[model samples]
Target: MLHADLDSFYASVEQRDNPRLLGRPVLVGGGVVLAASYEAKASGVRTPMNVQQALRLCPHAVVVPPRMHAYSAASKAVFEIFRDTTPEVEGISIDEAFLDVGGLWRIAGSPVEIAQRLRARVRAEVGLPISVGIARTKFLAKVASAVSKPDGLLEVPPEGELQFLHPLPVERLWGVGAVTARALHERGIRRIGELAELGEGPLAAAVGPAAGRHLYALSRAQDPRRVDTGRRRRSIGAQRALGRRVRADDEIEAYAHGLADRLGRRLRAARRVCRTVVLRMRFDDFTRATRSHTLPEPTDRDAVLLHAVRTLLTAALPLIHERGLTLIGLSLTNLDDADSMQLTLPLEARADSTLDSTLDALRDRFGSDAVTRAALLHRGTGLTVPMLPD
Candidate 1:
């Protein structure tokens, strides 16, 4: 079964520990509302809101900075409980995870019972509240968790997956985002229940051929997505908001190449070779789009990923060519867990591994973006990476 998530995690922790902060509006992160307590939410403070604006919404709200180490320590304790319950655990993110315990019903008890114990353990040990959603499929379980948020547990029986899923809004599906929803809405398809009426052909035409069929299948709760254990992510990548909109293609290419290089470097450091490149772009309006391509061969090299990223830039560059842009991210996928680099290829990309190693050393010594290529010379500290201030 799958578990959903925690509601207002950071703020919940802060409120649980401090008696005075309990029942009062609380906002984490003085710079931005990283997490806002339910009280703060009721008062109009929201996550990602600027502190000043949030303060205006709730003058009496308690504002605090994020304590990553404290949260990390708490998360570790929570994961320990998860491990104790099941062996197959998949970390969805820092805040949530999934556990596959298909046959543990006898020892671990029923899904509902296990969820109750797990939630209780998390609250008792880590002092943070969590909501659990149990279901036959990972997707449904995640949906269930959203339904039973704020220290609650919800279970969708095997036969009820479709009943629970189909009536909800289309935005609940994994890949359905704002743009896709808008496209569906344009066709008078608003609810997941209504999607069944379109039939697959009409639905496909509405939201692109690729996404429409998949979404139609999902509307009927027909997901075959496995809880993959070998999902040893090939790369760890991050994107920074440029703060201001950027429209030029050259600037976007240079920025994307830098990010690709960073992802490739991280993949190499972990001794993993990725055969596919995934590029994720978040437009100014908070909507995200992704494109990916499989390389001819596996590589942990910077230039290979950069070439694909640049190619993707040519495709998506047109959209942002005249418009404002906000965030861009790149990641490498199809990872070969073992670095089985066969040096037998007749045509090889330039062996710039040495140069990458040198640049990485420099960046480690000084800071990231410290040793950039000539192409990146004018991209002066574009979007900043978060750093500990002196």
Candidate 2:
């Protein structure tokens, strides 16, 4: 069984502590709607919506900057409670996780009893409400959690999975986005139960074999996936929206180099190196394209990755001009664990990798802006990307 959510997560935390903000429409960011209270969501304010637009929808909404530190602290507290209750626990995200209580089924009386205790502890100790869903599979557990929101708990026994899942909207299936849902709807399959009636061949004809078959399997609640121990991130990449204007290739390459440098630092910190570097370019018109090339060897060298990215940018210059490039991104994939210690290699081996790590250490101890590539020094923007602690 996995309890897979934080009920109103960020919004609920703010409302819980700040009694003044209770019951009023609230949003959690100044620039964009990072989160919105359910009341604010009713008025069309939603996550990722522009703050200005959210304000237009709910004029009285209290918008606050994100308090990530507070959220992280709260997550730790909740996970502690979860660990206390169950031995086999897997965290999927900061606010959502899985608790495998198979061992405690007898000790805690039953899964239901354990869930009740876990929910009570969260509401009492963490001071935030959450939703819990119990099932034999991770997929059904997630579905159950979504169905039972706002401090609710739902349990779906193994034999009752299809009965509980099939009648749901097509959107309930994992990876079914709005576009996929619309495609399914066009085939007159709005409900998962309806999809069950469309045999494999006809379903494949409608949405392509891979997607249709997957959806059909999920519709039947026939998932065999287990709660994995979790896999290390194969790559780290970041991109910034360049507003709605065309930028020259040299200017964009400079920014791309900065992004690669940051990614390289993260890779080194994670002790991971990549053999493939991917470049993503997005145009002002919203069309995007990506290209990837394998390096000579797996390396976390910034110069190697940036040189590849520059070559890609040079080749992509024509398309950038044609589509009006508005965004550029860099990613390192095909990873292997890197060594913290260095050794002499072929002439093409990293010359700056060691130097980069040293500088990264300085920047970490001091501040990032304290060190900069001499070329980027002229521009003075140190580095920009969302970084999660490795």
Candidate 3:
């Protein structure tokens, strides 16, 4: 198993395209820090941090707005290389993927050799630094890649997996977040070796049963999952982060409508229909909430989706008013191919279908801005972030 991950993907792309940003601290996005170069990270700048706070941490950092199209193109090019390397590539995100090269020992020399070649290819062809980790299990491979970051490579052989893993911190184990780390710290279990010696029963007592089993297994380097490429995305979604501000109900509703509109178009473009519409919100206090409504029938129509979105948003308005929202997100879930949808006879429904098809056609031929909703005319459409295929 090999896990290959691009280092500082967005920031790397920016630095690669512009020579001036090569060795400088580059921060992507305006309101929030989306990606930060290693130079910026050295100054304590982090992703999702407020840009102002990041600037305060790294005063000389160069802030750049996110270029989603460029990032998408880079992702496509890199994935092409991954597929060319191995047919068994499981993409974890736009910047990382797990590959199984077990069967290529005779043809490709060894796993370490394959990883070295993969990293070299990415740097030479894509002009970006990538880290590659080789191990017998997927979990160890992922952990190895994370440990050897920013253009580095490491291999954990089966004979020495424990020697490599046991000395690491307990936080290195998956699912050991800040809360879990504090709980384990209180128990005097700070290392993976310590946690493994604590026994599964005691670990379960410390954390919940399921998480305990998960962390305990990872502590022993016992992941058995393979790199699977057959899986498809369960949901398609989009969200916009609104800076700290008091937005009126109408403005919020407009944002919801805009999200629904974009998602509906995406669903149709992907030839998928969704059975559920979910509204996700983040309040100013950093708390998150979600409300979902499953429709009687799957749909890709903008009107149907917008209506469901508005209904969910309206129901959550009282809570939003009380908490003050900082973000709005919409997701269409329970997706199935559009060809599976049954045809209906209502004339109004047929008219709506025609309108949807016409608008999609216009947008595909000309541009997304070819048609617009009256409500969204003056209110600018929020940024369209790049996403993996649905």
Candidate 4:
């Protein structure tokens, strides 16, 4: 398995298209740091950081607005090169994918050679630099790719997987986020080998059963998943990062409604319906809370989704008021194909579906901005980042 990822994707695209941005710090997005060039990153700028703070970190950084269409085009071109290299491709996101070149040893040559050719093709054809990592398992391949970043290629052979993995930091494990890292750190288990020596029972006692089992298996390089091209997204969602400024109740509601509108359109566009509406909130202190409500029936209608979203938001309002909300997001999960939906008895519900399809058609023919909800007429709709098809 080979994991190929573009380096600083959005920022790289900006630098690629313009000569002035090359070899200089580039920051994409105006309000938040969506992507930062290696130079800006070296100056301590990170994604989702406030633009003002990013400037304070890198005073001479070039700030540019996001060009979604251009980025989408570049991603498509790179994926084309990936498919040309191998048919066994599993795209994780717009800028990264896993390609299984194990079968092509007889025809295409070694994995490293194939990865070198893949990188060369992307740079020559799409004008972008990509890093590729080869390993026996997906988890290790992804980790290797992250380690060999900014136009690099590294491979972990089956015989050396353990030798290469165990010495790394425990934070390098797939599920070890900030909280998990802190837990492991406080326990004096900072390395993968240290965590592995703690035994599964003690690890489970430390981080709960599921996560413990997960980390234990990964600490031993035991990932069994394969690269699957037919896999569909289990959930579709969007979020907006609101700066530190406090917002009114109506303002927050407006953002939630806008997110619902975008997500509903995406669900219907993909011919899928969701049974669960999840509300994700981030407080000013950077802590997060999630609330989910499962619908009695699956739906692809905007009105139905908006109602569920508003209900979840209302339930989280007290927490938001107490903690100070900084970000709000909505995710539609428990998904199924649209053909599986049962017929509704209510005439009003059927009419709502009709209106949703009509609006989707209009937006598809014209543009996403062509049709707008009355509530979001004057308010700014949150930024819509590009992603793999739902």
C-alpha TM-scores of all predictions: 0.69, 0.84, 0.94, 0.89
Sort by lDDT, top down from the best: 4, 3, 2, 1
Residue 380, candidate 2: alpha-carbon lDDT = 51
Q: Which residue segments of model 3 deviate by more than 4 Å?
A: 342-353, 365-367
Better by lDDT, candidate 4 or 3 = 4
Residue pairs clashing in model 1 are none
Segments in model 2 whose C-alpha atoms lie over 4 Å from true places:
13-19, 76-87, 246-251, 339-353, 363-390
What lDDT tens digits, residue by residue, belong to model 1 across residues 240-359?
556565556777777787777777667656767887787787777767788888999887767777888878878887666544577787777777754366555575644645876777
Tens digit per residue, CA lDDT, model 4, 310-362: 89989989999999999999999999998767777663334444878888889
Candidate with best TM-score? 3
- Pairing residues by index, what is the TM-score of model 4? 0.89
Sliding window of 10 residues with minimal summed lDDT for model 4:
344-353
State the local distance difference test value for candidate 1. Answer: 0.76
For model 3, residues 1-390, the per-residue Cα lDDT tens digits are 999999999999999999999999999998889999999999999888999999999999999999988999999999999999899999989999999999998888899888888888888998999999999999999999999987899999999999999999998898999999999999999999999999899999999899999999999999989988987789999888776889988888888888888898899888889999999999999999999999989898888998899899999999999999999999899999887777665623334457888888897799677887777787777888776677
lDDT of 4 at 130: 93
Q: Measured by C-alpha RMSD in angstroms, how accurate is candidate 1?
A: 6.4
